[model samples]
Target: MEGLTVKRAYHQHCGLAAAMDVLGERWTLLLVRELLLGPRRYSELLADLPGLGTNLLADRLRFLVARGVVRQCGVGSAQRYAYELTDTGHGLRPVLLELTRWGLFRPELSTVDTVRPRWAFLAVEALAAGRHAEVDEDYEFRVDGEVFHLSVRAGRAHGGLGPAQPPSVVATTDAGTLLVVCAQPTALTEATHAGRLELTGTDSAVRRCTALLTPS
Candidate 1:
């Protein structure tokens, strides 16, 4: 109620409608998507989301904060402000994953479309579909010079914006190669063999990750 804008209220009693009332606005869900991995500073959010006007970003952040979906907190010793998802905001993870799964079949990439390494984390989660349920492992990925990590625990995947400590597996590849592997998991072996994707770790850890990435 705190962040509800009366002017745009759907005035609907249904739960889905209520959710859409808050999230259906233009660029709002994308904002949530960007925050999925972890907390981000204002500048970081702006950089990741190109073309979203600064004023609109500010307004949306304010709305989300007031709605209790996100909160602002001190980040690092500098104490600069960063925005993070609250428990209520994390409740949208399933929704985002579902949307990602649905979008995967929509169409091929367009020339103007942009892809970021961090997004691959969410895409992997969507693609995995709980295949990592029995897995408790840490995977570090280096995509196009960017580094990120994924940790699977208790049947869910969690990602962060940087390297993992003592990762179980380390995967190095570019965005295109990663995309290809995700689309045709069988290509994982080929990609590794061809040196398009590099995987490193103990044989057992690497095999486990390879299986997770290339599910039957």
Candidate 2:
């Protein structure tokens, strides 16, 4: 807990308070996010969560390890190291998930997914300003993590989802791009025809996919 900090005056050394002590740092939450898939070597960490220096990474790793949030394992004779989440660290998945869902946009997403997912709550708000009233069909939206999925079928927008829900249309754009396309600028058709969007299923499937992203 050497580098850990407590910005909020909550209980200490246990439960939510303890988590905040380490995770309160903006980068720490991202660190948890970078490691969410499982284990990653230091280089991989740098790759996924770029902009973090080795010294800062070492500090975060040590802080996480000290707080029981992560563990380091030695790989082969190369003496390389990989960082992994402990059970406690794994528990932070939902925290980061909720944070992502709640609209956290790093500055890196203006044009590309890049190393960071630059998104904004305003982008989502603009897109979701008005949703189609009654959705009843099965639609898939390959949207980035920051935006919520709303499929308009029989007319009403659908609710939350599980991983089983296959996206009818998959676009490579992050939430920001998705938001931009849905709100203004590009039409789903144009994006698809232009190759920014790669349609997987039939033209009808592509149409249905577009409908999902259609602005309310």
Candidate 3:
């Protein structure tokens, strides 16, 4: 019997290999996904990745920080830490967006879940402002029966409860219709005519929100 020869799997110290080493795990990528949208405290991360255990989460975060993919920063009274991506971390944006575009294409599923792709959210926000300006203001998106509130400050976003303030604009549509609008160049009016989109609220605001969210 011939013995099998295993190739030496060595990744360069300062390349994509190094980058993958930092964010290649299942939960690790999602952690980056969350941060790319904005900063989040430990508990917020837990909520985002409910599948992660405390020990594993801590270890993964430690690995990211050591690789310069993420930075831990100070917060308020509880001294909660928020994580933001470094320059290297920002480079992963394209990769995430590609995956999201792929995910939206599941043929078997009848509709999108409206979970809000982190990369899409981040990309839209980036188009509106520079990296450091993401967390400077709060935002909210409502659809169907749910509302997602973003509490941003200093260019990071937190998903906790937000204050009482009217949204800059409101876009009302079902998850599936919104997904189509965001994935393609289709117009909202057309979607509505096709019986695919039912919406009301501020038309301008909705369009503004959709403009940033849809990749193409």
- Pick the TM-score winner: 1
> Against the correct fold, how does model 1 do in TM-score?
0.85
Query: How well is each residue in 1-216 modelled by candidate 2, as lDDT tens digits?
Result: 445532454566677776566677757887876666557798878776767888887778887888788999876788678988999887765455445434533323455445333332223322332344343444434455522343445544433333225555444555455544654434556666776655565677666555545553
Cα lDDT for residue 1, candidate 3: 12
What is the RMSD of candidate 1? 2.7
Kindly list the per-residue Cα lDDT of model 1 for residues 137-159, writing each as its tens digit: 89999999988888888677777
Which prediction has more favorable TM-score, 1 or 2?
Answer: 1
Q: What TM-score does structure 2 among the candidates reach?
A: 0.55
**Candidates 2 and 3, the one with greater lDDT:** 3
Q: Evaluate all candidate structures by whole-model CA lDDT and list the values in order.
A: 0.81, 0.56, 0.58
| Model 2 clash tally, residue pairs | 11
Stretches of model 3 off by over 4 angstroms after superposition = 1-9, 12-14, 77-79, 108-140, 143-169, 173-216
Model 3, position 5: C-alpha lDDT score: 24
**Number of colliding residue pairs in each model:** 0, 11, 4
Work out the TM-score per prediction. Answer: 0.85, 0.55, 0.57
Quick one: ranking by lDDT, best first?
A: 1, 3, 2
The ten-residue window of minimal lDDT in model 1 covers 101-110
Off by over 4 Å in 2: 1-15, 74-80, 104-190, 202-216
Q: Rank candidates by TM-score, best first.
A: 1, 3, 2
